[model samples]
Target: MSDSGPSTPPSPDEKPAKVQFNDNFAGKLILPTEEEIQNDPYRRRASSRRVSRRMSKALAIADILEQERQYVIGDIIDLDTIVEADDIEEATTRTRRFSSVVAASRKSQASTKDWRELEEAGDESSGEDEDYLIEWEGPEDPKNPYNWSKLYRFFCLFTVSMQGFCVAFYSSSYTAGIPGMMAEFGITNRTITVLGVSAYLFGMGVAPLILAPLSEMYGRRIVYIIGMASFTIFIIPACVAKNIQTIIIIRFLGAVSGSVGISNAPGTIADIYQSADERSKAFAVFAITAMNGPPLGTIIGGVLFRYLGWRSINYFSLIAAGIFFVAGFFVAETYGPHILREKARHRRLTTGDDKYFSRFDFPPATSLATLLRRNFKRPLKMLFTEAICLAWALYLSVIYALLYMSFIAYPVVFMGLRGWEPQIAGLGFVGILIGTSAGVATDPLSRWGVRRHKVDPETGKIPPEALIWFACVGAVLASIGLWIFAWTCDPGIVKPWVFCILAGIPYGLGTTVVFTNGWNYLLSSYSIYAASAMAGNAISRSFLGGILPLFAPKMYSNLSPAIASTILATLATALMPIPFIFYFWGKHFRERSPMLLALAAQSGI
Candidate 1:
């Protein structure tokens, strides 16, 4: 072959073809000399730039070799001996190919390194931080929460849901034991039920500020396990209480422990799902479990109360708490930072290196003052600033108040007014359950509507408005259920069943809509601050739930069941059109919301 000139130009009509070569080439340059290639600005920039972890690692090893002046032109690249080039031309091409590989690898690796630095920085910042880990800790790292098997997550979800169920159940279980409690304590006041129920609700509300923030410092799994184990351990003291005051104290403490079940669930779920659709499904599952608990609790509490006696409620709670404790051991830490910290821990241990550190490992302590600041300030900020959060909270609160109100009043209407037996009285709860089921059943229609109508031609995303329509249908059903239950109880032949069905209709549909929309709204609107926002919602909804029972008895007695229910149903009816209003104007409202605007701006929306 003829030797070409140093700067030969290509023919005007010819385009230069990309050079290809074997990996094992071990000779000098076909074109530029080593010094010239190194000095080329493009080559220098490409080499200096960040790349894949594997490539960076390879280059680092190559750098060490180069520093030792270890390369022999004729020798094969030892990194992979199988990769070889035959001649000088082939070797030149191979070196370029390997360099290209290194550059590409560095580019890929850069993302992992940048993410790690950010996560570590976040973890070290404060205990209240919520950043998730994104760095790889080798392939299929167990510390990566997403890498955890489905069975593991399901177990966690089940345990939390069960704990929530137990908490709600225990609130009412004392009803069966009230007589025993009164007899033992020489107390006959009707306020004991209120006292017991309020303690649990109060505990739930207060513990999150204390415990949830600590979850940032310690971890979600540890906090849940410790909390639930304490609750189970506290059950022994609560069950054998000789006086009302002792029972009250123990019960309150147990509730504080159980509160983790509800408080941390949304946070955990948020950490798991990355998309709106997945989140909607996850929220739906959680809503089913969370919303189903109260009625199920009442049902189970009544049976345990009647057959096993008042202490049996606590006994069952102890069992549930124990199961949760056992399950908690298997429940991995899902908090993003915690996962990263664990990965860092593993890497440190395996590689015998101190440089590997996770963001979760060094979180600051969230002190009482910080807790107070966060608890008081964040909620106020969210409630006042986020219109969607405020609106959804209001809607859910009203629905919950009505639910608890119904719970308080139902027994009286069926047992006292209609003269039903205790067991038959318990069956009245089925109406509520049936209503919940209806709402759950009707939810798919809303999703289908979203698929059918809300499609954006450009991005193909469903409008959030399509989801709100279910809320309207639910509200209308709630009004109807109220109307039927209100009017059908005059000892007529068709009274009980007709009333039950009517009561269920609205409740089922309405609750379904309420839960679906409320959860989806939180997931969509407050994607980053999902935990704090949901915490605020939990507080508001729980407060309404816990307090409604205090006045429900008096309201039913004074106004009578028909009027009492009608008033509630009427309120629901008035709120029915809320969905339509939101469906039309919701995005505008969100756009106008200062909190949402700030978040959108921050997220570069």
Candidate 2:
């Protein structure tokens, strides 16, 4: 070989020679022999192309390795082994292994895959010596709520549910005090006194539109703390208020603060239970507590008002709110994104590295205002645009309206017709409590029904619409109960116990089933946006619950209790078809909805 360095550019007419290397040759620069240079034009072109491609690949691999170093700290790279490789083939082989490891690590970072996928992937790679991403640290990470001890999870669930129960208890408990409030404030119009309760429900509806998103931005703990504390504090003023306006305004504010528990509790349940079956049980308990609170409040309030006085109702709520506030401290943060974000922050601080971040960490570039605007608009947008949300909201709203109207209807029958005192009349609500309990007890049946209709036979995962089966049954019962109660409420027709047991129990069962199933369907269908969907449900239900009672007295008086209630029963009967329609065709509706389609794709349904 000659050591000459200069080579002239080829003319347009001349073809470049190809270059060839020995099988054992390393990637060392070499001068060409005069004979080889003169004869090998095509080989020269091929050699140049090979060198360019290798250089590009090396640069790309270096970039990937650097990124891995920044985000992951471990035996992920072996620089010494690569540097010691004696030939291009050896180096290329090692680089391919590194690339494969990096690709596997990136795949593990993905959050959309279900637990089965993760387990299967683990089995497939059992023999490989690799450093996969540590998303949940082998599924036993204490930080992951899904891995929490059952006792601890139950405690958390109970605490959160209690918070919801307190708010709901206070919502209707005030109704029993309305007489005292009217007399004290010298309010002649019953409508004005009723506004005190309506104002609170309206606040409950509107506040969730803001607070639910705030809980997502901040953690659930902070929201619960602030909300419960404010609620407790506000009760003091309402208890001593001289005017009805003060009571109404303060009650509204208190309800707004307390709304956080109602809005975020379902999301907390989602965090703890990864499977729909487990979540259904939790939701059943939550639904039962929520449904029973109003009736329980009615009972408590009537007793307190009759014996201790009306202001004692506020004192009772104050005590409950205080207990919830203290309990809030022990309730762990169950929001997954919030937990991951905190983990990322801790890791970054401990490692002194900014790149150790969780996938859920919000972008630093995003502004608070932008986050608020997006989150605030999401629930309303879902309510109006998503077919599933719109239909379910309407269904839940009507059911909730009927439930509130029962407070009015019961008094009409037992007090106005039977001439029962307030305390005895309040006992009528026990039928609702019994029915709600019965509905909760049947959740296992609903779960079995869902499994029977599994969308994926292999995985046994059911569609969201599977929940509507309970709703369908509940609707029929509700319609029948309404008609029965309307007709049997007459004084001479049958005993009072007949209406209480036959009509109230079935109505209670039906309403609880509808509420529970509706919530489950919404939560499952919109998992990522569960809170937003819940906010929509709250808005519709509270709005109708508040407005429906305003007309109850007028309705009973103008049309007579039988005709008035029958009209409601007819409407309830008309709505009976809604759950059935959704049960059969909901999937089609979801397929057409862009939002539902995107959510389904994310959840791998």
**By lDDT, who's the top model here?**
2
Give candidate 2's whole-model lDDT: 0.67
Candidate 2: Cα lDDT at 447:
59
Error of 2 at 30 (Å): 42
Q: TM-score of predicted model 1?
A: 0.70
- As a whole number from 0 to 100, the lDDT of residue 209 in candidate 1 is 65
Candidate 2: stretches off by over 4 Å: 1-139, 146-149, 273-278, 347-353, 454-463, 492-497, 524-531, 597-605
Error of 1 at 297 (Å): 1.7
* lDDT (C-alpha) at residue 474 in model 2: 90
Per-residue alpha-carbon lDDT of candidate 2 for residues 100-167, written as tens digits (9 for 90 to 100): 22233332442222323333433325423233222477678888889899999999889888999999
Per-residue lDDT of 1-605 in model 1, one digit per residue for the tens? Answer: 00000112347996532223322212221223336546766533442233233233433332222211111111111111111112222322222223333322322433332433323333324331222222565667666656667777666666666776666666665654555566667885646655666666667766776775566556688888888888888888877877778887887898888777766776666555434455446656666766677676666666666577667778888887787678778766777656666776777678774444432233122244654576567766786677777777777777776776666666667666788655456667777776676666665676555456444333233445555656666667777877777776445534545465456656766776676655555544443354456667767776766676677666776777777777777887777666667778876776687765654443232
Best by TM-score: 2
TM-score of each: 0.70, 0.73
| Angstrom error at residue 154, model 2 | 2.8
